[model samples]
Target: MLKLEDVVEMCRVPHDKKFRLKDHDPGWAGDEDVPKAKRKKFAETLLAESSAELAEAQDRLYAADTWSVLVILQAMDAAGKDGTIKHVMSGVNPQGCQVFSFKQPSTEELDHNFLWRYTKALPERGRIGIFNRSYYEEVLVVRVHPELAQAERIPDAKIEPSFWTDRFEDLNNLERHLSRNGTKVIKFFLNVSKKEQRKRFLKRLNDPTRHWKFSPSDISERGYWDDYMAAYEEAIAATSTKWAPWHVVPADHKWVARAIVAHTIAEAVEGLHSTYPEIGPEKLAAIEAARKQLEAEDSDPD
Candidate 1:
């Protein structure tokens, strides 16, 4: 997978000051009509190689106890995030792997600071953790519905502009602290086009296996179109940094998006320099003695 930095670098247009998700005409990804057979072949190759390498790298990560990896994925509805997680992470060892899918806050979750639930889900050292959607929702969703922000118990004076800015600072600081200690953070924004999302939504309603995934409310959210786009653009611009940046992935093609994700994970995992711990001299001698004793016992079994 391309580094989030690389993808953003390639896909964005620098405006007067900040960047946008690129304002291309028909589609953001371009040429979604590429022959399925060709795409399938390319995707198959990437997935196979990446899966093998990911297994090796994660084995080292599990053995070393050196650091943790945090991957946060966010996108609009029908952005293929669930499918992405399911496919991209197929090779990681379950023992060392964890995936968290965040949703609407429960009563208990609603009672605390927005960061409260997120902090508790961070990965332990020597593990890989994934968040399907994370703390950004506090800024994005709440910004759209000002009422929720008020319910957050933040002081009116302390709220307004400080809301998103404060969260960005908190996130940046938290990431820096984690990086200083050992963790690596990677964030992905599955950048599906509005038209493509509509197609996906229609498919969900039309296809049997996917029918359960759709809701009338999903279409309703589309009504807040430009508001969500502004929120996303601001969130991406504010939160992206050297420590932990959000990668805006081209998601019109599921294969391309999945390829990038798998490749990126393999690349990050490979950087850990993890290896199997060496056996001690005492343990080696014990193993030799045990082997000899077992052989002698077998020899006398007649």
Candidate 2:
């Protein structure tokens, strides 16, 4: 079976200046041993297996109740964020997993610090929280549109040249704090090709079932594709830390991407060293008493 570690070396973005999206092949599927015709099927099978592993690991995490995990997914439009979340995380117990999709800010959200909205959504210990588009947008989208940054007006504020750099520092500090407090952060950037995005967008327009997903704004956003790419590159480079590193998952093929994502999550949770809580003497005595009562009731046979 192809393990998550098998692909991590290829997918994880190195924390260095040489990290570039153009160097990554969005269509690269794992396991060169598998033939091209059988790769998709094989990857799907791996995804199912990985999901089971993730579910078991998540159960341990929940039972231990000593640690938490946060999975952040970021990508261009039509990059399979929804699909990846659905298929890759399907086997996880819903009680232990929560998913949040960040859209435009509300009036109330605008009133606070940029990170305030997300801070409220952080997962509790012993659970997994997935963010579809997370606080990274403060640097990505806000950087692309400086007008959005103007809304975050500080009292008597002066715009500084290091604004974006400062925001990255804040995010790094936040992740460091979470890590110190037992929340492991895992971030994924679905590396979808521009050509593939166009095809997916067309499919959405041509298919009635997906028509609702198509919007004029989506088309407008395409105009800023290069800008968005640059923003993502810089933001990722600035923030990808050992405590909360970014994985650039090739998303041109949904199956392959899901397999990588599922395995990565399973591996991360498994590495947390969480285990089912050990029963104490008091709990064992209680169990013994319950067992005796049950045996007595059976003997009475009313």
Candidate 3:
């Protein structure tokens, strides 16, 4: 079994202002002790163990009803965010988890503050909320294309030097607020290499079934790769806090990314130290009475 500490240490971004996107290797698989040929199986084993732990922790979280978890995933196209989420969270009860994919904003959504739509979708206590792409988009995609911000039509919405900085502060404050209110926020950036992304994009174009996943816009965005990288570096550095931190998971190997994500989530939920709610004396007595009545009914000839 992979130690949670090891997995976290491999993926968690430090809470420092000098975080650099280039420092992390998108193709990292884990310790060099594991031979390349065996890494896939090792990742599967780690994922299975972590999935079991996450399921148990989720049960405790639901019973305690004291805290909620918010998982945020950000990645370039074809980085396997959907697959990671699918595999890592496969064991969780659907009723206790909600997954929201934020796409193009509606007219109604654009009218509200950038954070308003996301705030409304936060998970209530006892549930886990997953944001496939979230408010971080305001800093990322908007930074790459300044035209989108202007489209919001905010009064005096100037693309000044401090614009990105102000948005980062807003994100930090919002996460701190959520933390204070018993919501644990965890973010992940699935770091994929440009070469790997190109390979995947080509595979999609060649495969008939995956053709649906291809979009002209996806290729268009590739032109802004450097811009997106700078934006991600700045956003992650400014927002990774004690209350919430970003995990830069290498995405070249799908199994490795899934395993790390599963382990990290299980660790966070376990850290909550949640337990089943204690039954009061009156409730216990009522339960005993109902149990006796049920036994009597079962024993009766009628």
Candidate 4:
């Protein structure tokens, strides 16, 4: 099967502002035309293979004993962030990977600096760290609701005029710092259409098992979809630097979305300097002897 990355590169994009993965939502759910059955199987199969590839890549990093990855995902509600993490990362070695989901800030979290929680979660050497929704939220959500923007500690004089500009600058600086420190960061925007979001929202509302997933407040955000898209466009344009280019994954077809994200991650991981620990000769000999003894014991029992 063609990986999601390849398909995304080839997907016939709709007429929604030349909606590239990096700029706009692919609007899959409401897109009755996305060929759901075809996409579902393709997405799952690629996810399975990519999972193995991720493990192998991590093993190489373990041996190499250098470099880690930071994969940041940003999207609106019901944009398949959880599903992507669930299916795409199903095969990676757990010890070598971690996924952090950022939600509404608590009282304690609000008291600290914006990047406090994220700094603690940076991946150790040879591991992969995924942020389900991350530091970017400080800009996105806070921008959407000015009241929430209090978290940004900008100067009172410059706050109103340069709020978003400062955010993009901060984000750009942060990613650059990570790159210099040997952590390769990749940002993904799962672009889904407004129409598709409505379908997903409805599905969550109507289905009993999915009932717990629905939130009435989610609809309130839908009104600002256009505003959010514009925000994303500016964010990507302003911050997608050469060292950390953002890939806009088309989420209308979850398979294509999965494939693209996984492939990109696999490629980045494969490019890293990871390798297994080199066991000494004495340890190798001891293990060989132990294996022979165990084999002999099992044979006698049989």
Q: Single out the weakest 10-residue window by summed lDDT for candidate 4.
A: 11-20
Give a tens-digit lDDT track for model 3, residues 1-302: 35668768767877865788899899988677878768788789889998989989999999999999999999999999999989999999988999999988899999999998999999999999999999999999999999999988889878976998899999999999999999999999999999999999999999999999999999999999999999999899988898999999999989889988998899899999999999999999999999999987857577
C-alpha TM-scores of all predictions: 0.87, 0.94, 0.95, 0.83
The model with the greater TM-score, 1 or 2, is 2
> Which portions of model 1 show Cα errors greater than 4 Å?
1-17, 23-40, 156-159, 294-302
* Winner by lDDT: 3
* Best candidate according to TM-score: 3
Clash count for candidate 2 is 0
Candidate 3 residues lying further than 4 Å off, grouped into runs, are 1-4, 299-302
How high a TM-score does candidate 2 get? 0.94
What local lDDT does model 3 show for residue 76?
99
Superior by TM-score: candidate 1 or candidate 3: 3
Tens digit per residue, CA lDDT, model 2, 129-190: 99999999998888888888888775655545488889999999999999999999999999
Give model 1's TM-score versus the native structure. 0.87
Better of 1 and 4 by lDDT: 1
Error of 3 at 183 (Å): 0.4
> Positional deviation of 223 in candidate 1, in angstroms?
1.4
